[model samples]
Target: MSKATFAGGCFWCIEAAFSSLEGVNQAISGYCGGETDTPSYDAVCSGKTGHAEVVQIDFDDAIISYQDLLTIFFTLHDATQLNRQGNDIGTQYRSAIFYHDTEQQQQAQGYIDALTQDAVFDAPIVTQVTPIDTFHSAEDYHQGYYQQNPSQGYCSMVISPKFNKFKAKFGHKMKP
Candidate 1:
């Protein structure tokens, strides 16, 4: 199994996006790209930890390729929007890829470069390709939040719709 880490918007939303995929083994909601070793949700939200809300996913490479994951990552969030995704405005909501190795970094940059050349969006893609630093696991309640609290306000109102659309577009890539 290989791992991929990403921060597109809220960890909740991004986790939901990749957790149920065909190759995914574990989906962890955490904090990365930060100054501190461990940061709380409130601390990160305060915009002082310099962390983006990220999800670390473990997947089988034989079942799904990293390039394919990169494609889904770009599709899930408006990478053109800097330090924010929709109404979740903050550095913690920025688009980023916490690459585990040089290969991952190269692939991410290559993907972004291709998107730019293709003019995938009117604005430039701002997703940062950073090395995986210390990833502090978010509070227990945060892990699998959407799955556990499907009826919660944010899950029901925001994540559900986004996840449904993602499922529609990537259904062929997901598990049964």
Candidate 2:
């Protein structure tokens, strides 16, 4: 198994998207790329912890490549928007890929470069490719939030639409 960490906006959305994939063993909501030793949801949301809400995904490389995961990451959120996604605004909502090693770093950069060269977006991709830092798991209630509360307003209004788009594009990759 291999791991990949990404911060694309709300960790709830990212967690729900990746958790549906076949090769993914787990998609854990957390905080990363921050100075805080142990950041809570409120602390990160306050934008003082320097932590972006992130999801740590454990997956089998044989079934799904890191590059594939990167592709999904880019598709799920607006990498062009700096420090925000939709109504959510802050450094904590920035698009970032926290690579575990040099190889992952290179792959992420290459993918971004390819996207830029191809003019995949009208705006420049602002996604940050950085080294992995301390990953602090969010409070228990945050885990599987969408799964547990599908009827909630935010999940239904925001996360569901994003997830549906992902499912449409990558339905073949989803677990049966």
The prediction achieving the highest TM-score against the true structure is 2
Q: Quote the lDDT for 173 in model 2.
A: 98
lDDT of 2 by residue, 40-101 (tens): 89999999989999999999999999999999999999999999999999999999999999
| Model 2, residue pairs in steric clash | none
User: Candidate 1, clashing residue pairs?
Assistant: none
CA shift of 110, model 1, Å: 0.5
Quantify all predictions' global Cα lDDT against the true fold: 0.93, 0.96
lDDT (0-100) at residue 102 of candidate 2? 96
Which digits, one per residue and each the tens of the lDDT, describe model 1 over residues 68-118?
999999988899999999999999999999999999999999999999999
- Model 2 scores worst on lDDT over the 10 consecutive residues at 34-43
TM-score of each: 0.97, 0.99
